[model samples]
Target: MKIATILGTRPEIIKMAPIIDEISKRNIDQIVLHTGQHYDEEMSDTFFRDLDIRTPDYNIQVGSGTHGKQTGLMMKGIEKVLLDEKPDIVLVQGDTNAVLAGALVASKLHIAIGHVEAGLRSFDMTMPEEINRRAADVCSTMYFIPTAESAINLLAEGYSRKNLFITGNTVVDACFRHLKIAKKRGIKEKSLKELNIDKMDNILTLTMHRAENVDVKERVVGIIEALKELDDADIIFPIHPRTKNTLEKFGLFDELNNLEHVHIIKPLGYLDFLLLTSASTLILTDSGGLQEEAITLSVPSLTLRYNTERPETVTAGGNILVGSDREAIVSNARKILDNKNFADKMKNAINPYGQGDSAKLTVDAIEDYHARGLLDIVAPEDIMNSFKRKMKNIREDISVKDFERKENALVHMVFDGKNMQFPTDELNLNGMVINYDKRE
Candidate 1:
């Protein structure tokens, strides 16, 4: 059967690489679609080249726009591509606007939709990503859940239990693969050295892409200052396009333009980021996927964002929820730097997400689901159990919060560009409150 993979943005490209690679190895009929969420060549093209993955089957060139506009463009564009390719199923990774768009088009066209990294919920609907993921899950025919916990999440949401596969995370698979390849080829970590990092250095990596962090003056300033504080260690930053623009706008461009300590660089390709991350000491970011990835790799992370969907990462002690607190960023970082015991504990912790072969398991499950002719199925018990376990885990170790609607109010949590400041206990959401609840 023909499988179409949809992706946009750098993270999607990295996560989708393994799936794409596997499909090619099997000589399966695979088609790739680039949603062009961020059209910069550095971010998008570099990932494909760095991973040694093939050029996209089609580049839609959708570019960045308003959330609704971007999603709409992708939906319309992907529908046409699906009609042209007419694949058995359209596969998408993570919870980007592209995923939502591709899922929407495929669902409407009566084509099967497979969602990778399914069943993740931060329990915060305020995030566009959470909205995109939930919508995609509701529409998917097959779920490539990265962890057993993710499959349980689908079950509680009342999605089809049988279709959920406990695939090892493709990201981890890609991470290990790329690091090996990059090292074997002697693709020197020269850029890292350019930051004056020594061999076996403990690097703290940072990436900021979201508009919220870049949309304002103070927030942007706060981020640069935060980076400035990360001294005596290499702070390798792979900046996103919008983030690059924001940094330039705030006139901190020259300060970090080529600063000695803070290595301000453009986004790296798949293998580069993977190798860089694999060798790093700690990750400081607001990325959900990276948070899970850090856990699997056993690298301690200090989240730049206030909250996260993958509270399990924090509860397991591989991650810290700092939420843009300045004092917290510097202080906690020092604590982590000084504490050898904490580093060892988090490094060996279980990767609650998955073992890194989710694509294979998911494809097998999809074939089985189709063979059963049970396309119109939703399995609630499976997801409910997973959610319960996660909630139970959160309750035991972390503080849990529930949100109730304040009439006509838009909910938002402010982040001041601090490092791992907030306690993970604060992010242990007992459960999620979505616009609609679906069940089997």
Candidate 2:
């Protein structure tokens, strides 16, 4: 069977690397598609080179845009390639717009979708990632969950146990694999020299690029103020391009740059960053992948967010949630930096993600599922009929107004052999009536 892996951002590339490499080793036809969500050479191309990932088969340059525009463009681009290649299954990793678009397109075309890091929920609908992940999960045919907790989440959500496999996170696989390469290449010494750091001790690696934290000026100022307080530690911030643009927009780039201890460098390649992560005494960031990496590397981390989707790290005691509050950030950083016992406790916490063999497990699960005929695509008509039956059951409990509200909120689209059909007429609660209009 053929597999088409869709990835966009740098994190997706890093996490999907091991799985892609594994697919290459097996007797499977694999296609890699890049959405170019991260367009810069530093952010995108450098990572492929660092991880030794083969050049993507397709790169639709759907660069930065508003969420709607970006996702739409990705859907259009991905659908074209998928239709041309007609792969049996489409694999998507993280909850980026690319994942959402890839899953939606694959589902519409009746191709199986395998969500690699499925069943992650931050529960905050305001975060676009939460929505993207949930939507992708709904559209997925196979869920390759990372942890037991994630599996429980899927079970609670009524996902079939047969399709849910707790294949430990592939980030573990990528981390160990790339770190070995980095060590062999002496990346640690090279990175330290490049960053002008004489010692790796007391290093605080900072990375904050979440839209929630960086978009708000108040939050950005608060985080920077907290960083200013921690002058004792060397802050090696490989700044994300978006965060840099936002800082410069708010006139805080120069202020952050001028800070004595904070080193605002361009985004590092995966190997270099992995080396830095391994060497850091403490990490401060709002990234989900970094939280898992921190636990894997036995480093203490402070998550600068109100809540995280990767609560495993926090529960395992490897990471702490300090949010964007200046005091909380400062207090936590100091605790990890000054108190050796506390730092040791965090460093010695169990890595809940998994052992480094997750890629093997993930690929093995996929191959097994396919052999068992569990990855077959459900027909669109069957899917719609099933959805309609569920909606009919829901119609029994809700008021007519509530039903109408819910139905209107949904984009009622169905494929009709040659064209797509969207319901234009309002359906009453008594019975459903869908009027189709040809868009073309």
Steric overlap count per candidate: 20, 0
Give one digit per residue, the lDDT tens place, for model 2 in 1-440: 99999999988888999999999999689999999987877556656776688889999999999999999999999999999999989999979999999999999999999999999989899989999999999999988888866776775576655577778888888888888888787654344557755464699999998889999999999999998999999999988878999999999999999998888776776777887889999999998999999999999999999898898888889999999999999988888889999999999998888888888888898888889887787544644334331223232434333544556433232223343222222323333332211111
lDDT value for model 2: 0.82
Which candidate number would show the highest TM-score if scored against the true structure?
2
RMSD of 2: 10.9
How many clashing residue pairs are found in candidate 1? 20
**Model 2 bad stretches (over 4 Å):** 43-47, 187-192, 249-251, 379-440
Clash list (residue pairs), candidate 2:
none
Candidate 1 weakest ten by summed lDDT:
387-396
Candidate 1 wrong stretches, greater than 4 Å: 43-49, 186-193, 216-230, 247-260, 375-440
Cα deviation of 221 in candidate 1 (Å)? 5.6
